[model samples]
Structures are given as structure tokens and as C-alpha cells.
Target chain A: MDDATLVALARSGDGDAFGQLVTRYRRAAFLVALSVIGRPEDAEDAAQEAFLVALERLDDCRRPSRFGGWLMTIVRNRSNNLVRREALRATEQIPFSARSSTPTPEKEAQLSELRDEIARALGELPEVQRQIVLLHDLEGWKHREIAQRLGLPAGTVRSHLHYARKSLRKLLKPGE
Target chain B: MVDNGSIPLELLDPGNSDPGHWARFQARVMALAGPELARRRATRPLTVGEVLASWWRLLVPASVVAAAAMASLLMPAETTPGAGIAIEEALVAGVDDEPLPAVLVADQVDEVAFLVAIEGGG
Candidate 1:
């Protein structure tokens, strides 16, 4: 069934319906969480937490078609909250898996640096700006949809995007 | 600034556009959501002990307060040589006059779910 139908059923106390809804959006939700937290385990934890929160408050969802964005907003909020509370703990540096022996260390090192730069740029954006960038550019969200999901005016979404881009531009400038 | 039908590519394009980014992100997402897809029901079933343990968290505190209230009721008059406040007398009398309330099973079930739900994943 489509997400709207599942959501309608879910609202009526159907855990099955809610479960289907979770399956439908879990990918986008996980990615959003990962994009923010940069730690796979923490991303998994935050995404799961977001799902639990969504299940409890399923009735609060107004437009069922907006479920994907709504679910994503939850993960983003949770992941950012996790990062904030953990004080980032340490820089999240995703090391190459020991199981992989394909790429040379030089190539792996460059990739790791790229990963760090991308994550650092993402981390430094203001909350609103970070969320907009992640949802729109990384997550392929449309502006109108983000505005609706976030309860921000369309203009506000655009403004956030503008600032987010400017900040990223400065961060990714050539040579440090 | 070249605009594609009023869409600014600079604004619209992914700053580090690798189109592959979405692909990898999607792959990881699918992996995460895979295990819990079909097993959505709360069917593991809360054991009686589990239920009571869950309930006791709230029940014990509420019971303590209630007991204290009941003890306060039965307490003797404070004005008398050994009597405590009227509230103490009434509290004791109330408990003695009545047994602890029924377990309130339905409300307790709801209480745990409500707690877990609002707090999100443990």
C-alpha cells in the first residue's frame, strides 16, 4: 500500500501499518541521521530512536504524503541532538575496514581526508543551515517539501539554503 | 549565472555532487531498515515480572505517597499529648479502613508503553 494508506491505518493503532511506514522511509531517515552524526552505530541508534518517537506520535502527522520528510526531520533532530549532547566526543573519522585490502594507503588516506572535510563542513553549518543542506543536497529534498515538513516558510528555506551554500563554499575553498 | 528554467544550478547542484553519494547513502539506509521490516508487532509480550517491574517504577512511588497519606490520616490529633496532626490520623485511618487499590493493570500497561514511547528508544 501507499504511505498514506499505511499512515491512515497506523493512526488507528496498527503497529503493522506503522511498521510498513517505517520500512518505507527508514533509508532516508538513516542517511539523514548518518549525515549528521557520522558514526554508523550512533546513526543507527538515532534513527531507531526517531522511529520510536514517530510511532508514539504518529497521530501528530497531518499530511500523510509528507511522511518521508516528516520522518527525516525526526532523524535529523535526533542525530543533531545526539551530537550536541555528546559534545561531538571526538572527530568522527571513518577508518577503512581491515577486511578491505584493495586500495593503496595513499588513495585511502586521500579519501579519508575528503571524508573529514565533508563532515567538518557539514558540522560547522548553523542548525537550520545544516538541516537544509543535508535534506536538500544530500537527501534530495525539494524546497517546498522541506518548508512543509519543517513548518518554515518557503522563503525561509531558500534563505537557509543560501547561507548554507555560502558557508560550504568557504569551507571547501582550495587549499585549507 | 546560468539558470535552468529559473532553477539556479549553482544553488540546486550538490556542492560535492557525486550522484554516487545518494546511492551509497541509500544502500546503507536499506541495510539498517532491513531486519525490523516484518517483525513490527509488540508481540514479544511483556512478562508478568516485566510488567510489574515497569509498573513498580511508578507504582512504588505513588504507593509510597499514598501510604504516607494514609498513615498521616490515622495519626492521632496533634493537639493531644501524643497525637500527631489530623492529616496523619486521617492517613492511617484511611489505609486501615481500605486495602491498597487494585493493580490497575490497564493503566499500568499504558504507563509503560507511554513511558517508552515518549522517551524514544532507550
Candidate 2:
């Protein structure tokens, strides 16, 4: 069913309808949360909290068909709140599990530094640009889908991603 | 910017699939939402506990007011309101004259008043 119909049903206390909405948006929600929080567990927590809050305040959603964008706003707020409350208790480093086992200690050390630099760069980006970059580059989401979810123009999403990647490339340049 | 393929964006993605985690997460959200849904039902009556829980913020102040009221009612009237009669005596006479204590009458009054306010405002 469409999100608007599901939202109406959910507002009337339909658990199944809300559950379907959850299933449909869970990935996007998690990705958005992860973009802000930078940890899977924390992102999941924030996303789940967003869902509960959204369900409680479903009647406040003025545009029912735009549920995805509305929910993303909630997710972003929840994540940023979590960050503020926790004061970033967890490091925003992304794990480098794809590294080859045969690397020497010096090479491994360099790779670790590069990973940290990239994480710092991404973390420092504006929240919107960071989310667009992560969704586009990492999850392989189309600009159109990101635009729809984020309530942004497709061109704006592309521009943000381009700038974000450009910044990442400059920050990760070798022999710095 | 030179080729930066050496940096892996996928590493930061936190892979998009995790059925087990999502299931547990959905369950937690529903657990919270289930009671909220019930509490918000316009047609369904809220249980006493739910009502109290929902209005717990007002509980302490109301209780304090009630306690103060009872204390005031039960205390000996150093200065009677009129006819040199204590407030308790007047309430007792107004009722069935069954000699009910002034404190009980005040308690009943408080309960009725509270219920009315709740029904009126809810």
C-alpha cells in the first residue's frame, strides 16, 4: 500500500500497516541514521526511536505521501540529539576490514591513518552533504532516490555528492 | 583530486543488510508503539492505571494539595467560620447527620471534584 494510506491506517491504530511502513523504510532510516551517528548500533537505536516517535506523532505529518522525507527529518534530529547528549562517546571511525592480510606493519599503519583521515573528513561535512555522499557512494543509491527521501532537488543532491567526494579525495591525497 | 580508489567507501556504509538486528529493532519500536496506540484510542476507555500514568506529572502536586486539604479539614478549628461552629460540624450537619468525620466528607468532595475536572478537561 502507498505510504499515505498506510499512514492513515497507522494513525487509527493499525499495527500491521505501521509494520509494513517500518519494513519499507527500515533501510533508508538506518542509512540516514548511520550517516549522522557513524555507528551501526547507535544508528539502529536512533532509527528505531525515530520510528516510535513518528508513530506517536503520525497525525502531525501534514503531507502523508511525503512520509519518507518526514521520517528522515526525524531520524536526523534523533541522531544529532544522540550525538549531542553522548558528546560523541563513540569514535566515528569506519572499520577497514577489507585490508589484505599480507600488508607489512608500515603499510598497515599508513592505511589506518588514511582511514582515520577519511572518517574525519566525512564526519566534518555538513549533515546533508555527508548523508548524500554516503548514500550515493557507499550504498549506491541513485540521486533521484536520495532526493525523494531527503526532500531535495535531484540537482542539489548531485552537487552535494560531487563536492563531498571532491573533499574526500583532497583529504585522502597521498604524501600529505 | 587524484584517483582515491584506495579509500573504500563501502567500509563506511555499514552494509545495508541485517535481518536479525532489524527484527529486534522493529520489535523494540512496536513494544513502545503498542501501548501508545492503545492510550491514544479515542473510542477506547483508558484504564485507571493508564490514566494515572499518563497524568503522573500532576500526581504529586494533586496529592500534596489533597493532603494539605485533609490536614486543614481534620485540624481543630481555632477560629470557626461562623456561629462558633467548626467547619467539620457544618459538613456533618449538611449530610445525613450520620456523624461522619469532617475529614471523610472533605476527602469525598476532593474525589468528586477531581473526577469532574478530569472528565471535563480530558
lDDT of 1 by residue, A24-89 (tens): 665557556766776555776788789877766666888787887688778888997888877756
Candidate 2 lDDT tens digits, A63-149: 999898899999999998987777666565443122223445886566554545666667767778878987777666789978987
TM-score of every model versus the real structure: 0.49, 0.56
| C-alpha RMSD (angstroms) for model 2 | 23.2
Instruction: Name model 2 segments beyond 4 Å from true.
Output: A88-118, A138-141, A170-176, B1-8, B13-19, B39-122
lDDT of each: 0.63, 0.75
lDDT of 1 by residue, B81-114 (tens): 6555676466677454332222234444566666
Docking class of 1: incorrect
DockQ of 1: 0.01
Predicted complexes: DockQ each: 0.01, 0.17
- Which segments of model 1 are wrong by more than 4 Å? A10-20, A34-40, A60-63, A84-105, B1-122
Cα lDDT for residue B88, candidate 1: 48
Query: Across residues B1-122, which tens digit of lDDT does each residue of candidate 2 receive?
Result: 12635447654433422337667767888788888777656645556898988789788889999999999999987855665878767666856534433334665567666666668656
